[model samples]
Target: MAFTGFGGSTSGTTDFTQELVSATGLAERDRPADLRVWPNPTPDGTFTIDAGEARILGLEVLDASGRLVRSLGALSAAPFTMELGGLGAGSYTVRLLTDRGPAVARLLRQ
Candidate 1:
């Protein structure tokens, strides 16, 4: 398990399984290069996703237990704001299904 935050590039194809494993890790170290989340530990459960150069095929939000909490489906926009105001405060995982592969990011709702 590996983890990373900020500073990565979506320059090549990535293995979905590996990306998922890296993203799900507890520490921040080895996530995909192209994915980024801002206003993390979001105050109102709202945040932005910026996938540089990578085409996003799908996006989903999962609870800490790894259960699907919200599915945004296929998105045409690259940089977009996601609203999680409906859910309670805690930890969440964001999975991005992209042309390169799947990227995962941990989120905290405050």
Candidate 2:
């Protein structure tokens, strides 16, 4: 599967959804080379993403079924706090775009 950049869809909703699902699935499959996420199953309110030596450009949170829940823009440092209070109780994926590569972590809401 190919990686698709983040954007809205003007095409058919079904096609767009499929493409997004495929792209996000592919991204989750390939782990980042240098980033890390602490407290594996994250607490419901906040969490951190550590980029190690890499620079984190942004972060995206996805629901269990691969739906985009939130996009965190332009992190200023290696470890950044993300608010998860509005998220529903379930499993979520946190994807980080770093200087090294993309990093993905599974977050659990309690």
lDDT measured at residue 16 in model 1 versus the true structure, 0 to 100: 37
Candidate 1 per-residue lDDT over residues 1-110, each given as its tens digit = 43444343488644433235634553443345388998988999989998887778889999999999998877788698999968999999999988667899999999
> 1-110, model 2: which lDDT tens digit per residue?
54454455678443322233453554552545465666666655577778776777888999999999999777886677778777778888888887667778888876
Clashing pairs in model 1?
Answer: 3-29, 3-30, 4-29, 4-30, 8-33, 9-33
Superposed by TM-score, candidate 2 places the C-alpha of residue 38 at a distance from the truth, in angstroms, of 2.6
* Number of the top-ranking candidate, with TM-score as the measure: 1
- Give the local distance difference test score of model 2: 0.73
lDDT of each: 0.81, 0.73
Candidate 1: where are CA atoms >4 Å away? 1-33
For model 2 the local lDDT of residue 14 reads 37
